[model samples]
Structures are given as structure tokens and as C-alpha cells.
Target: MSVWFQSTGRKMNNSSEGQLDKICESLSQAELVAMIELQLSEVDMLQSMFPDPRELVVEDPSVLCDLRDFAEGRTLLLPPHLDLIINLNVGKGRLSMSANLPHHYPAVQPNIFVRSQTLNRDAQHRLNQELLGYLKMLQQGDLCIGPAVTWLQEKGETFFDDHPEEVTKSDANTMETKVIKFARLWIYSHHIYSKVKRKDILDLSREFDLTGFCLPGKPGIICVEGLSRNTEDWWHKVRSWNWQKILCKKLEENELKAEEDISKYRRFSVFEELGSENNIRVKSGGFHVDMGDVFKYLENHESGYVFKEYFGISGRAT
Candidate 1:
């Protein structure tokens, strides 16, 4: 019975292999050659347009060799995908784009990754999403990289224009003494692994000029302190975002006598993500913040008592 089963399995495997060969044979060699030619021509055009070797990097040069081999009929299968990293000057900063062309590239959309130091992570994410949406609207077999670059060159600066520096500048220019109501919020979440969520947290905090820190990992902790209105707005926006489990664990509010008195109520000078610092030990496999580091941070800030509020433990012994 075992020998009969083995023979049946071998026959099934041979049938599948034969079907794969038939599919490969059905693909037009001429069409494959045309795709390779188009890709090669596009690479040349990109190099010519950029005119700077530093601006473009072909991640795997072997892909080009494979293309040549397939074009010359030396190989039966299509070549591996072409990977390109392009750096472009946009506004006051540089935009780095990684474009991966799949085997049937112009017919299918390329995977795009966009990064910019000038824009915050949220802005970068929005820009990349917009670019992807633009690609999807294009007709199939469209050579897309050039148009994508053009789109970035034209509209990318808008993302950088709304930097946190603008908010800082606006605050600095205000000369009137305003009575500020301060508020601090402690938020707890089941986990904070999503890049988009982390970016949103940073962007929202900076937009509202909130100062505190976010410990992003399993059992994420967020602390934001600022003008009562701004902190409320931040919390409102945050709550609108999707979360598996999130709650406002604690809320502290106080009225500052004057703008200068804000220091008395504020515990943090800047909004930042804190789990990756030298003082913190992140658990392996996941970005888990150490409770000991959290206690130390709170102790240094003279807010160590809140550790009990966060966890039932009276101290960091657990």
C-alpha cells in the first residue's frame, strides 16, 4: 500500500511539472525579448535624465546579466526583477525612492518605497500612498518610473512645507502672554507594532506642540503633555485611529498662572519615541519596552509614583 501511494504521488508531481512546462512554452519568446529591451531602454533613459551616477543605483547588476541571457535565448525562464534606488532633490531635502520591477513589469505595477528626511514619517507615508494610487490609475504596460519621479518633483515639496519648524516659528512669533491650561495624558494600548500608527503618534504630537514620549511595543504606553486644548485635540485624533485595545489610563490637568509657569507642569521637553535608547533593553523578536527603563525614566522625571498607576506593582520589582 505504501509503494502504491509513493507511485501515485510521483505521477501527480510529474503531471504538475508537465503543466508548468506547457505554460512556460505558451509564453511568447518575442514578447519576453520586447520586455527586456524596453527595460534596458528605460534604464538608459533614466541614467541620461538624471545625469548623475550618485542619483541612481541598480541594486542587483546580475538582473541585467540575466536579462541579457534570457534575451539571447540562453535561458528558458524570464529574468529576475530589476531593483532600482533613486535619490532626487526635492525642495530643501532629498527623496530616496526604491522601485522594484517584477518579471512582467510594465504590465503590472512596480513596488515603490519612498523615504525623505525633510518630511515626517506620516508625510512620507502619505506621499508614498499617493504615488501608489497614481500608479494604479495608469494604463497597464505604462513605463511608470519617469512619471512617478515627475509627480514627486512637482508635489513632494508640499509635504515638507508643513514641517514642525513652521509650528515652532509661529509660537516664537507670538508675543502676547497667554494663560495656558496644561494637561498630561497617559494612554495604554495592547500593542503598537504598526509603522503607520507610530508615525501618526509622532506627527500629531509635534503638530500640537505636545511634549512627552511614546514607548512603542507590546503594551504600548503614550504620555503627552501640553496646552489643554492641544492635548485634547491630540487625544481626539488618536482615538479615531484603529486600535485593537486602547484606553486613557490617566489624565492630569492644571491651569498655569502664566506661559512661563508651563515648566512646572511639563515633565518632558520634547515628544519622542523612547524604547530604542541606550538605557532601554528591547526584548528580542519584538519591540517590547522594559518596565525597568520605564521606571527609571519616570523616577528621573520625579513622576515615579505613576508607575503604580500604570501597573499594579508599587515599584519596578516585577
Candidate 2:
């Protein structure tokens, strides 16, 4: 292994920018040799772990060209905007990241950018910050850039699992222009009993940007409404579950019209959190629901009725 930390700290702590760049160029070459040797030594293990090149999206000619230039002591122009976009599947959702290697590469971390339609701006920034943090955590002389893609894939998967509402694609046009817009999915199952299963359904629903609930009973019923593609994606996952019967049908114009009539009141949750109790029921159904009657209804038929719980956050869904 390269005694990178010792040399790096000494050279960097003493040298000017021009001298440091020259020294970094030599260090980068040695690091490349070490990386190549390491790869060759562990070729079989790597091949088994990562058999498909398509999964990484780092084998493109542009990437090769940039690395070649860097190796040849050439300072390539940094594009004002993102030069390459790589799409990756992170958990149930997809993610895209644009990245460029700095000329000083192993010495200085690569410039990675995220323009996320999946996550909010703050989350996007956090992802980049965390990636940089991970790079900083690495011991010197390691294949520093090698960890970035893997780290992103793992971290992003975890983030999506936790948030569940942050999947995005590079294309936003489809979201706005697609017709046959709204869809309702009715998934029927007998096996969705445990709290774990319920939470799984809730997480999946949020991931696909669907709004619906699991009606508590022996045979479970899940109702969700969203854009057709998203609803279809949700249905596909529902079928994957060990469900007795899963049937999905598009809601007609008449049904949508009826839903539109109550659209104004739809924002009002029938169930609300007051103090200590969960799942308070609303009796009077208008834009405004009486809390006193809601509490009374919860008290009366709490055990008898199976209430469908809505776990979706309104603005978070795509």
C-alpha cells in the first residue's frame, strides 16, 4: 500500500498550489498502479460480487477519457453544468446522480452533484455532504473514488426505506402530461395481519406516491389513489405479496366526479390525534368535523368496527 498519509501531510503542509499539483500527479499514478494490482489480485471475488457492469454505470467512454487525461497530466475543462447522468435503483425507488472527477482526483475528492426530484433540496444536499464525509473517513492511499458509488447505492437505499416518498426519475415531463391521470387500486389479502405487514404496506404506498389504507379485518383490503403509472407500480408490488386475491380496476369518470364532490372535505382527516388516544373517529362528515362526537364514536364502536388508517403525508407524495 502507498504510505499516502505520511507523504501527503508532509508535502501538502509545505508546498504551494503548483508544487502540490505536481506532487499529486505522481501520487495519483502510484495510487492507480496499486488499485490495478489490487483489482487483479481480487478479480474473482469482485466478479462474483459485481457480475453486471450495467449496475454501476461507470464504464462509459467519457469516464475512461477523463481518467486518461488525468493520468496524462492534462487539466481538462470542468463543465459549468453536469456532464454525465447515471441512473441507479435504490431500494424500491430510482435515483440519478451527476458526477465529475476533479483533475487532482485521489488527492482531492470528485465533484458529485445530485438534482433530485425524489428527495427535497435539503436531502439532496445532505446526501452530497454525507458522501464527502465518507470520503474523508477513508484511510489515505485507498482507492478513494471506488467507494463513492457503492456508498451512494447503500445510503440511498436506506434513505428511501426510511422516508419511502423520495423516488424520482430524470424525466419530469411524464408526471405533468400523462392522461388517464388518476387510478384507484383495491388489493385484497388474508395474510396481512401483523403490525410489520401493515407498516410494510404503508412504506410501499408512500414509495409509490399512493394514498390509501389497510382496512383491518380477516381478509385485508387496501385502497389507494394516485397517477396511473404510480398506481400500477403499487399494484405490481401488491401482487408480489402473499395475497389471496388482488384485483385492480380504473375508477370511471362518474366515480371520480363523486370523489371530486367531496374533494374539499378530503383534506380533513376522519381520524385525528388529540391527547393520549390514537384513531379518534369523526362522526359529522363535512369540511369541519366535530371532535367531541369523534371521541364519542371512538368510545362507542372502537372494538366493533375496523377502521382504514391513512398513513400518507399529503405534500410528500409525488
Candidate 3:
């Protein structure tokens, strides 16, 4: 079946028409049309920027409705999922979320959640907080999934950089019973400016046989990826340091907790830009530390690192 639309001045394709009919069964045509138009506009905007617009996929909630009794929850099942393929300077990431409208949307808020592996409990709570903020600003009865997803994509890079996790965890029951667990430490410290403090972290990295990059500054980030046990040990040693004296301490203690497995990076070594003045260096068979232009030499000799898996998405993964 096809429907003629004066807006596009063309006959809608059979597949789209059928989709629209499915939505119309549960929602008023006016409301469904408005929702569909908003979604298509989002797709068009994404296609303009990305090589493959299909990466930004939106699922029809009506399909999920067939499997559940909505009356039990008294919620409108729309915007089942928004899957985004995010590419940033830090790395490639994916984010997915679900927004279910309450019986009285705009008056009663929608329940939204993050369904991405890249984010943990704290991160999910933070994202939901931001989504609620958007809800408050919107007019009563306004559809919200579009704006919430747009905000997520814009901020995804920071999310991944701050809370990067392994894309896949090994199963102990599988034939490959040897499971390698790793953890990523995003160290934020003001003491990094001091030569002594800088060396302390580098020394710890060598002692643990971990590989990661450090961007030295008053409040800089140290991205480390390595075995979970060693990473936890390295982290505790860092926590015990005299941070107050150096004026460099963790901003969020909870964010620094170790034991999480990092399944992404294949090997350990810091990746740095060749010309940076404060680039961390390796010496004595990658044991000692230098604070100069030595990454050029290491880059030539060190094996390149590989990302083992793509970022994980939530809901029906695209």
C-alpha cells in the first residue's frame, strides 16, 4: 500500500506506507505523522554529515508494543531506541537509549535511559539527568527523543574519553579459557606539572607493565590500559601519593575505582604526537621515563596498538 503526501509531493513507498499504517493503528495519524516527520528530518541531517546515514538508526516503538501490554505500564511506547554512530578525535563510539512517554507526557515526564556498554551506572545516571533537563525545557506534549539524542551525540566524545570500557569481555566457559582483563585509568591530577609527580606515574606504569599515554599538565589526564590486577595496584599507588602537597588529586574518587576489565586495546604503549613538548617518554628497554621529544624514536621501534572491538550500543544493536 502507498499513500500520497502533499508535503513531499510524491507517493510514499510501500514499505514506508506500511510502517506508517502500523504506527497509525496505535496512534492518531496527526500525532504519528508529526513524529515520523521529526524522525526523518533527523535522518536527513545525519546523512548530510556522515558518510553512511544508516548508522543513525531509529527503531519504531510500535513494533515492541506488540510484545507487551502497554496498559500495565500506562505508558506510550514511542522512541523505542535511538542508535548513534559517533566518531570523535578520541575514538569511535556508539550510544543507544530508550524514551518512553508517560500517560501524561509533557505534564508527566518520560522515562529515558542509556543502554550503552561504554557507560556504567554513574554515567547512565548523568546522561538521564541531562535528558530530564531537556524535558523540563520543552513545551508540554512536545516529543523529546530527537533533542535528547542530538545532545548525546554532541557530548559522546567526552563520555567515551572519560569512561572508556572494553567492548567485549571474554567468557571463562568458552574453549579459550584464558581471559585477559584490563582496566583504563583516566587520572586527573594537578601535580603532573611537577617533575617528581610526573616520574612517579611513569615509574608505576613501568612497574606494572602497563601501556598508556600521559598528557602532563596542572590538571591533566593519564589514559592507561592494562591487566586488571596490575592496573588496580597502579591506581592505589597513585591514590596514596601526597596529592595535597602537589595540589593534584582526583576530582571524583568513585570514578577512579579499579577492577573493571578493559577489552578494547590489544597491547600497551603510549601514543603521542611527535612534536608535543610535554610528551611522556620511555627509556632502558621502555623502563625509565623522559619528558622530551623521544616519542619519535619509540614510535619507530614500538609495535602499533590496535582497538580490538567497536564501541557497544544499547537496545537492538545496529
Q: Return the TM-score for each candidate structure.
A: 0.46, 0.34, 0.29
Pairs clashing within candidate 3: 166-263, 182-262, 190-218, 190-248
lDDT of 2 by residue, 1-318 (tens): 333444345322224434544654565454544333343333334345556665434434464454444434574432121123456777766666555443333444434544345665345546766777887777654544346667877788655435333444422335444243455544556534556457756776776556655544444456665655555555544553333444542242212332244333232223222222434332332223333433343335331122222212111111
Task: Please provide, for model 1 over 1-318, each residue's C-alpha lDDT reduced to its tens digit, 9 standing for 90 to 100.
Answer: 001112223211112323433533444667557556677777888988887778988876788888878878898777666878799998787898877665444544556767765665446657877887887777656778888999989988877755588866665566355445789999998888878679879987997779998888878889999878677656755764445578889999887663466767788989998865637777886586578877888888778888888788865722
* lDDT, model 3: 0.44
User: How many residue pairs clash in all the candidates, one count each?
Assistant: 0, 0, 4
Looking at model 1, the pairs that clash are none
Cα lDDT for residue 170, candidate 2: 29
Top TM-score hit = 1
Off by over 4 Å in 3: 1-36, 43-54, 59-93, 98-111, 141-143, 160-318
Instruction: For each candidate in the order shown, give its overall lDDT on alpha carbons.
Output: 0.72, 0.46, 0.44
Q: What is the alpha-carbon lDDT for the whole of candidate 1?
A: 0.72
For model 2, name the residue pairs that clash: none
Candidate 3 residue lDDT tens string, 214-245: 65543344656666555655564464443422
Candidate 2 Cα RMSD (Å):
21.5
